[model samples]
Target chain A: MTATSFHFGEGDRTLYGVYHAPSVRRRRPLAVLLLNPFGEEAIRSYRVQKIIAERLAALGAAVLRFDYYGAGDSAGECVETSIDGMQTDILTAHEELIDLSNIRRVAWCGLGLAVPVALSAFSSANVNLAKFLGWDPVISGSEYIDDLTASHAKYLADALDMPERRIRRELSMQLTEVMGFGVSESLISDVVDLELNGSDLDVCDDVALIGRKSSGAFRKLHGQLTSTASSVSIEFDESVTWNSHQALNSIIVPNDSIAAIVRALADGDE
Target chain B: MNERIVQFGDDGRLSGVWNTQRKNSNRPTILLTNAGIIHRIGAHRLNVKLARRLADIGFDSLRFDLSGLGESAPAAGALGYERQSAQDISAAADFLEENGRSDSVIGIGMCSGADNFQRAALADHRLSGLVLLDPHAFPALGAAIENMINRYLDPYRWARKFSELKLNAKTLSLRTVRSKSEFSEYGGDTDEQGRLRPPKAEFGNELRTLTKRGVEIGIFYTAYVQREITRATQFFQTFSDYQLEGKVTVNVNPRVTHTYTTLQSQNMLLTEIETWLKQRFTD
Candidate 1:
């Protein structure tokens, strides 16, 4: 599987992406647009997304994995990033992939909070979409932010909280930087607004939300999606835990998760 | 200053983001690679911070994936991981030279990344300097014995250590050994006691050779390695007949970890690196 790294979008704020092209002999009907988790989780999930792209490419379809604007290798600063700006990046990446390959049919595989990003990207766009695959989909933006806060707390607990935090002035912040990514005041407001909309993944028919059974939130989300949308649970032999402060530096495959992604992408093979 | 994604090397399989400033004199370039499998962001976006900060100071930097790591495709050659990584580094440097990006380059890596860069710097004449962070650990008997004795005397420290280990053990039990990078993190449950000594004889030889060649070298050792080797003197002592005082800059910081996890730690590392580059590589 061959992958090419390129920048897309118009002048100013060009985004970085790794596009895995189809095999030599033949190509499938679908190409995947892999959206990443927000903040540091995107960095943690970089390897995972690349592997998924390669596997999909190996199976005869092309896949494009991109960094949201103002994040990763993408242009712009973290503080300048907004939910709307990132959604525009997703739409831009979607169009660029289609133009690059001249293949109309596209699928999505969003991880964690990025599931919402995928939904919002194709929400209004009239694109040839086949499958909607979300792994450990964050039910709502507020819930995800809450979990992020909890993760931040856990990180502090796990780490030797630096004594340097004792600054002269109060730690009054207009925004809190999650992990290493700076979450701007506008972005926080945007996320809260997203949460208020609920976990309605308004999209085309095919939907598969895979979540580790161990997570109570995931179990609830699975039930909600199955009842509300054309969603099904993609199960693995063993449950996976993708959210841990320890995962920041490590590269993990989550075999079951990959297998689930393969099954989801292979659905529209015809 | 401009930052853009660059597809460098032969056949364009290698990928990197170039952060450059319009230059007249050739400033020393910072060559950054993934720390093990951690990717070009370094531990806690240290490389990104370093690159952008370097750009502010008019120094160019290209942080890229080494062959199969991160976004770069895997190398097809029969070369091992280390050699492939070294070749990737050389390819990046060649790109810089060809494009008139910079005439001088300084390689930076930590842990195994440092090992590969050091191996390449010893061989590659294009490398003007290196910033080795927690490069390698060897048994420094004096430091090891001193730490053990300190632990023996400080019962409260021992208790805290025991408690930390217990909590860590719980997390360790859940994690499966998946990748070679992850495997190296554990060190294979081997007895690491008295392991920090004189670094391999070759490391010292390379240091002496690089210093003689007028290559500015700045090495940072975290408390993790410092506890074992103790002080900067042990490094010179490791390689006898090599008086590196003023010849090389060796910082033994007992506050930082191998991977700077905290914001303060990351800031301190960046500041030290910038200071070193300003003093050592300035024309």
Candidate 2:
């Protein structure tokens, strides 16, 4: 396998990343782009992403993993890494993959919000994404904010000897004062507007894999997507567990799973 | 094996160990919080490795238990999310500060300890950084399942009985909620089919507060199923805007679960965190 570092220009800031190419130098059929999660989870899961790139290379597919402008070994600050910047990063990486690897077809695997960014980016760029894999696509950003709030409320109520409703109300007002951006308003409106049925994307023959152990609510959302999008394939893989005991903490993705993905991408060649 | 009781509130005493490399070394402190049902010993091996690693980088570390689990005093009623654990963390921070080890406090926690870091960072301004191993953003599978069973078996009678039990529990001690109706209303309930779910509309309001408080947050997420990481990243990005200076960074380990224990995986994680902390703290 060949691993090399490169940089791409995005206006003033230069986005940095590493490309993993298969050892066998035959022309590749597809290029795989890796999108990571945010915050502490990202720190813990760094190696697994590298392993994925290497495994994909062994399978004869070109793989690429890059840091957003503000994260990893890249330039910029955390505050400057916005949703728009991340989307742009994905688009830039996609172009680099095509140009460097000379691969006409591409597949995207996004860890978290990367999926949405990829979906949104590919659609906007008019890139003919041959395959897509989203690991628990966030249907609504606002709802996720709600989940964070509920967790805090639950803890406060249990700890402070206060009523849960009272804590919830107090926490809400306090959060509003703190967030200043009116996250509650944004979250509420976003949740109401979110549609995960792939209605926002033009890509056909896309597959969404939802972990059975993450949340039943997410599984239900996948079901909704399957029904709404004709070309979208939804599969519930039992190996993926987010919060449950079945979730293996040692490494998020197992070798078998990586092999399975490699097989799937290779099988697509036929 | 080396354990000492560090008292926090009147009745709360945390069982933990303080590993000091040497005198006058000015080492940064690492505070570890244990996972649910797992005692301090369960985390000992991992904590030891972490402590040694941190010490090598010029830092001291402490691993402790919250109020209920391990050797700490048990809560009178349901511990739930261990919200009080934040207080315990504050007390730990105070201990570190008193010993001159609080200048750069980096908290490394699992599950509830991870949650406590989020809460503690809000209260304690002394913390320089936090590392959450495999935190669950939502309730655990067992809790959700129990909630589902309670709702499915009997709605009215169960609610009534729960309320009565809660009232007694609250009256007898410094319990949070006094009645079942109040508890269900606050905790949320399952439908007839028994699926424990969160009311996103209401919960979003609370997260807005946590994010706005400017706590540096990092996540090591293992996406088992498809789109798990995507959903999590979206949540963080949306909320990160409220973070202190808008600093939020995440790395997804593709096939690895929440914890990085494998020799190869752990080394990669350590190197990344070391690099991140060095840059973040120095800058």
Candidate 3:
């Protein structure tokens, strides 16, 4: 399989990610356009996205993984990016993926914060979506932001090897940064107001919402979405959150989850 | 800095961000690669700062991914991953030239990236310069002793060192904790991906070739690499066969971690790199 990288959009914005083209010939050319998490979570889950994309491509699907606008290799700065803009980017990526691969059918999948964007895109998608896969999707922005803050606090406390009070004091006194990404009040407000369940999301033929047992919010969101959609399936995996400090670096290939999703796609094909 | 996404290479598989000034000059385009798994934004947006700084001084820069690393696709065969990385660097340079961005190109990167581009610069005359960050080197005996004294002498550093030396107590190796964990250039148990650096003999030969070809080189080392190379002058002594008198600039810093995680460390690094560019390439 060969992974290609390129940019396409208004004025050709600079975005970074790999396009994993299947080496083996497929009966039908099905493309997968992956969406990444927002901010530091985006950095954490990058390896996971690539690994998932590679696995999907090996299953005879063309996968294109990219950084959203104002993030990573994209043309602008991180603070410049928004949830709405990211949703548009997803739509744009979907169109670009189809054109690039020359494949009519495509799937939209994302991890963490990417789930909200994927949901928004799927709901408003002009073209029919083959599948919408969410791997430990974020159900509420309020919860997500809190998690971000807590994570940042923990990271800072651990990084400086200081007490929680000292870390809190430092954050309050100084412009607190999460990892390398500087967090802004407006950005936090925007994210907090977002709720995945509140969004107008449409269900496709195959909707596989997979998460770990420990992922309460995602699992609950998955159950609710699947129950209401009249179409969806359930799958379980090792509940390790790559967004945390422990599991970010190591590449834990979701072999079983990949097989499950592949099976579902194959079933959809039949 | 004005930025553009450039897709140039075999089948347009390679992607890069070309940061240039609106008003052009006779400056070279700097090509940057991922320091291991870290993307074009760099470990802590180091590449972004460096690129913008170069543009401020009328020079353009391109930060990109090597094949199978970061955003770029993997090579068909994993056996020649290092060879492919060299080719990727050359292709990025070719893209800049073909687009009329710049005829001269300088390759800059950290750790594995530094080693890979160093190899490329040794072979490709098109790359007129190299800014290597934390490329591996042997530590000299004298410098090792001096470093030990410096570490023991400083109270803050001394405390940190002594804290880690507590055998029974749970202690994190600063090497494994701060800069590494996630962004460690070389990770995992297996050598399946292959080594980023060339053998010692080949590296010496390449350094000689680079000097002979008149490529200006800037080699920067952080605390970790300082531990590896020991002395700043050891680079000269080890590569003494090559006429490195005016050809190479070496700075070994023990103040920063490998990835320059802190704002202060990152600022220091940018200052060092920008100063080097001004002296070597910028007119």
Candidate 4:
């Protein structure tokens, strides 16, 4: 697999992306667009994304992984990141994947926070998606916000060795940043409004949701997708933790998860 | 500021973003490397901010990922990571010089990036200045005393220390908490990802050589878990015989985390580095 890094998008909103070209040409060209999660999760999950892209490329699927305008090595600041912007980024990336690969069949694998963006984009995008895969999908936006808040508090307390009272005091202030990355209020409001339901999954022909382990959110999302989706598959891999302090700094290569994703993307490949 | 994506180095495997001033100038290019495994964007997009900041001050900066990290493809060779990193830094410098950007380069980084910056400076003469954040430091007498005093002054530390002492007494362990020598300079070293640290004396000699060679050095140490630099002047005081008075500048802040998790801390670092650059290089 050969990976090439470049910037793609319109003026002022140019985004950074890495295109992973397959080693050999397949009978029917297939491409996978990997959408990253929000803020700190994107940083933590970057290696796994790269690994999955490489693995998919090895199996003859061209993979394109990118950062939104306001994130990663892209052209904008973190404060500019929003749900609508990210949904647009997903569309832009999807178009880039098709243009770069010139392949009609393109599948998208959204990780964590990207799950909702991918689902939302599935309904609005002009191009037809071959399949949609969501890893550790966030079913409830309000609950995910709570999780982020709690995680940020825990990280601050543990990192600084602060008391619970001090932690509470720190969190009581207006939160413009989480962990280390800055987040916009508008983005927070947009994320808080997101709730995965059967409506979003109705447009997707093939939907697969994978999680580290089966949780309430997973079962709920799976049920919703199964109820309305044309075809749905759910799987679990317990090798990785996406939002833990212990796993944040480490470059995790969840072998089982990678294998599962590759199998899903290459299901119809010869 | 004008930003352009660059793919240089052998086989065009290296990837970086070049941020430059709108008007061309003969200023030294700043090369920012990867902070550990995080991409060229640095921790919390610090590198991107720093690059643009330098550009605002009429300086060009290239923040790139070393081989096998970020967008850079892994080299098909058996070279160790350290040597490969140094080579990559040299290659970045070469890219800048070849593009008629600048002949001299200022290397800036934090944590693992700082370590690599220092290592690359030793082998690459194109590096005119280095801004190191939380680089490797040997335990010094003053640092230990200052650390103890600071801990004693903390109200919560006493209770924590007492609990630790009680646990130690119950375990009957002679092992006192000390930074492990074999672990990485920043700690969390495992068999699969162990960090190689050079001896203090050897590192001191390297610093002496850099000072004699007239390389501008700014070493900033933060409250890292594995940091032994508890005092601001610990680097100079530890190697007092090296006479690094005019050659190096050291700043240690125990309140700041290794990655500068807060916005204020990030600003503090950027201001310190910017001030140091202005003072050292008036060109």
Candidate 5:
């Protein structure tokens, strides 16, 4: 695969992305956009996401994995990241991919927290995508925020060998940071209000939810998506946890989940 | 400032982002690599922050991944990881020089990348300076004694020690063996403790040669994790006979982790690096 890394968008809104062109040309080209989770989750899942992009590109699908503004190598700080801004970034990335590849048959593969980002973008924009893949998707933004905050507290407790209760108390006094990245009040306010229903998956013609565990939320969303979407599938293969203190500073390339995602995205790529 | 993607290496496979001043400057280009397998963005996107900040000061930087990591393609040849890393660092320097940028390069690395940077500096004279973060350190008796005393004095350490007592026999044995090894590169020469390292005398000789060649070195150690070096002075103490004080700068920060996970740690590290670069490189 031939990979090209560059900054897209304009001025302070510029975003960074790596576009991987397929090794071999196909009659009908397919494009996949990989959306990342915020903050430390993005860092932890960077390798796995890269691996997925490489694999998907190898299968004759052009892949574009990008950092939203205020995240990754993008033009803003983590504290400046907002859910609304991320939604706009996705739309901008989609336009760039389509304009570059001239392939409108594009699919989005949202990993971890990005699932909600993708859903929000689809609802706010006129994005009638070919397929949507949510791997270890976050169904509730509030839960994700709480989980990350707890992970941050636990990480500090473990690293400093402090009492967990004491760490929790200190963290509660100031909930401005999560796992080392600063959070903006506006971003927090927007994310906390986000709770995705099965209707959120209505933006795509086809949808696939792949995760390590099965939950009532997943079951209900799957059933709901099955009726509204032309085709929908769900798979579970435990390998890695997306957000946890134990997984911090550890590289996890989930081979099983990657394979399932590849199969889902490349289903009709013949 | 301008940032653009660069692919320069064998078969045009190595990937990097070049952050440059809008107008050219005479400052030496900074070369950054992956901290272990964390990719070119560094832990907490520290590389991006550092590169942009350095650009504000008119210094150019290239934050790239070693082959087979991040966006860079894997090497097809049979060269080992360390040898391949050295070659990759040289290639980054070459990219700068060939593009009319300054030939002098300063490498900033942490953990495994620091080890790779030091090795690369030894082989490539183009590297004029190095910022080694949490780099290698041979065990020193004084540092151990100091660390033990500090640990005992900290009331929090008492709680940790009690918890550590609950560790399984296997985990305790593993720690004992690791404690003996001190430090070594991965998949390299090994001994009973672990990877084999040249005797301290030989390592000191290499440092002397680099200093004689006018390579300005900045060595930093962090105690956020269970590191081999517990104190800042331990690095100089490890090679006290070499007389490296005037030629190199050494700092040990107990507040920062190897990865610089917290915003406070990142700020402290970036500030130290900028201050070091200005002091050592200013014409």
Candidate 6:
């Protein structure tokens, strides 16, 4: 596999990405645009996405893994990048991949916050997405924020030798102060408000939802998806851990889960 | 709720239940690991609660008995806690995969059960994640005993006794054997005049080995749990550099005890699991 660097202008800002394609030219059925999680999760899940791209290529698929305006080797600061900018980055990447690979159809895979962001953006932008694979999409920004607050509180309590209750109160205040427009809140709230219960997202012929077994939230989200989407393929792999500490650090891929995704994508084409 | 006799290890088969529920979509398969010495029936209510809650959210979960505990086949040896339980976890995952119910697998274990899951997870990449409730560090047994003694014994007096003994003997070695005569000399197990005893083994080395492996770890602790939260924290911090870039999380449920008796505490754990799964497995 060989990688090439490229930049595109969305509005006044620039988005960067590293494109990976097979050296030998072969007819490819679909091109994939990769969307990643935000903050620390993005950093942790980078290697996994790289592996996924390589595997997809080996399966006769072309993939482009790129960063939003403020992420990775991309230009701009994280604080400057909003949900809208991230969506614009996805759209730009999708267009560039089509032009570069000469492929008409595209598949999207979004992890964590990116899933909801991508879903919300896809609906609004009217992008012709052939299929979407959400690893574990957050349905509620408020719940996610609460989790973050709880996690931060625990971390602070351990570090500062303060009571967890005190830490929780302070963290809540800090998070409340940080909420604003052009922030992640809009993206988060949009996901939370999304009516995931039916087939609305089954806009494409093939849609796959993957999640860790221990996550109740993803299961809930999946329930909503199953209720709405017809011909939507959902597979739960007990081997995959999403929100846990081990997933961030390990190279393990939950082979069964990946295989199921490959099967679903392949079956969709048939 | 369904019961089936499943074979474990080479020649052991035990009766176990398979609880199934239909949700909105196909949710991931969860294998619940029970605590040591706890039978499947003993854990049945709690497991049912957890499974029902997960199903309500869109997941399908199964809680099973480890071999030699509950209804499963008896352990072949005394070290049943580790080997048999690990095998049971592997078997459970295989069962789900074979039944076409799981595309990914997650293991949630309590106490020694958690340790077994950790070992099984290391051996099987099919397991995507692990949730450990009140995991005990091998060294914690000794530490707990020491702490209990320290709470009752006068430290200054013990120190003085040690110093005097060292001065009297050229080389002082306080090794107390548990022979019958020695027990009598120390006034028996319930002693009126007995010396403090040292632990059989130091657990730090074993713990270090476990942390060195690239496995995702989440631990829930209570006041009575063998290992202190500080030890788990230190393990993660010291080995953060060696950890698989993003796959380690250590959490403590302050509202819950080792057993997770309260609904609120259980909810906290469920919430953490949900959030973590969304982040790890979702797009």
- Candidate 1 segments exceeding 4 Å error: A121-128, A140-143, A149-175, A192-199, A237-252, A268-270, B101-103, B138-160, B164-199, B223-226, B229-241
How large is the interface RMSD of each prediction? 3.6, 17.3, 4.3, 1.9, 2.2, 20.6
Highest DockQ among the candidates is held by which one?
A: 5
Residue range A158-202, candidate 6, lDDT tens digits: 333246687577755544212110235454454346444334456
Report the TM-score of candidate 1, chain B only. 0.84
Clash pairs of candidate 1? B138-B195, B138-B196, B138-B197, B139-B195, B139-B196, B139-B197, B140-B196, B140-B197
* Candidate 3 lDDT by residue in tens digits, A101-128: 8887888777788887677766666678
Total backbone collisions, model 2: 50
| Model 4 lDDT at residue B20 | 68
lDDT of 1 by residue, B4-25 (tens): 7787766787878888766733
Better candidate by TM-score, 1 or 6? 1
Cα lDDT tens digits, model 2, A181-213, are 112344244333545554654465756454334
Range of the 10 consecutive residues with the lowest summed lDDT in candidate 5 chain A: A241-250
Provide fnat values for all models in the order shown: 0.17, 0.00, 0.09, 0.37, 0.52, 0.00
Query: TM-score: which is higher, 3 or 4?
Result: 4
lDDT of each: 0.73, 0.56, 0.70, 0.78, 0.79, 0.57
lDDT (Cα, 0-100) at A86 in candidate 3: 86
Candidates 1 onward: DockQ, in order: 0.27, 0.01, 0.15, 0.48, 0.55, 0.01
Give candidate 3's error at residue B207 in angstroms: 4.9
Local accuracy of candidate 5 as per-residue lDDT tens digits, A206-255 = 78877554566667667776676375666674656645544545666556
Write candidate 4's Cα lDDT for B1-283 as tens digits.
2788889999888999988664554778889988888888887778988988777667789999999888888877867988999999999999988888767899998878988988898999888898988677777777677767878788886776676687657443322222254344653322101334567777777788887888899988776732367666667778888778667888878777778887788888888888888887655
Highest-scoring model, lDDT: 5
**B101 in model 6: Cα distance from truth in Å?**
59
Highest-TM-score candidate: 5
Root-mean-square deviation of Cα positions for candidate 5 versus the true structure, in angstroms: 3.2
